[model samples]
Target: TQLLEQSPQFLSIQEGENLTVYCNSSSVFSSLQWYRQEPGEGPVLLVTVVTGGEVKKLKRLTFQFGDARKDSSLHITAAQPGDTGLYLCAGIGNTGTASKLTFGTGTRLQVTL
Candidate 1:
């Protein structure tokens, strides 16, 4: 069974703090993607890495795909109140519908101003 699980289901931090969230699974994935969504809004794609050991960065946010393709991580260098949101990782399965994406449990981050 392929599934993505996120750590620290909840996080509360002051402004300008650094944090990292992990996504792990025992099954391999064709592609791994990260997304962030604000309250009452849909998730917005942040980055997608198809190759193993791939690293992508978006400003203060960094993402890494495991060499085994079974895990991923998101590192935030410095977070602000504007960075507060739900961070999610999605694994695109090799089988099943092409557009199917299995999402992680999600990590709600609160950056206090």
Candidate 2:
């Protein structure tokens, strides 16, 4: 199992700013996923990177996986107030079950106007 670590536990920024969040692990993962959560709701998956050095972009967000499969990053361009939420990264060692995922602590982003 991989243990995930996220950087910048808390972030506060203005609209139109750009930010990057990181997730690192010592162990390799079969797949890694990024998620965003609102105050009162569960996390929603943003993107899943299964291949090493893979990058996936969603609108203004970009997700990248490390070539060694031990790390990942998320970059947001031109932040928006509506993007405020708790971002999470989850590493999966195997595809067996939902219980096998190791989740990062999380990065709380507050984008202000």
Candidate 3:
């Protein structure tokens, strides 16, 4: 079981700008998921990628999984102040009934108008 790693611990950008966050791991996973979180609330699942080389887009957000299933990326377009929050990536380890997820360190984004 490999641990997920996220880059750019923090990011500050102005509204209308764009950014991409990355998640990497040494071990391959069955699936990868991205989430957004606020200070006082639980994380909200943004996207999930299960197949290699698969890409999913949600409005202005794009999520891509590496061909090897060991990495993923999240890209945001025209970021808005409401997009500022904690972003997390989680790799789902397939262990049957004992399945577990390895979460990335986390990336905090601040979008200013």
Best by TM-score: 3
Worst 10-residue lDDT window for candidate 3 reads 93-102
Q: Which residue window of length 10 is worst by lDDT in model 1? A: 93-102
- Cα TM-score per model: 0.95, 0.94, 0.96
What's the true lDDT of residue 111 in model 1? 96
Candidate 1 structure quality by residue, lDDT tens digits, 28-49: 9989899999989999999998
Q: Order the candidates by TM-score, highest first.
A: 3, 1, 2
Model 1 stretches with alpha carbons more than 4 Å out: none
Q: Write the per-residue lDDT of candidate 2 for residues 30-56, one digit (tens) a residue.
A: 999999999989999999999999999
Candidate 3 achieves a global lDDT of: 0.94
Q: What TM-score does prediction 3 earn?
A: 0.96
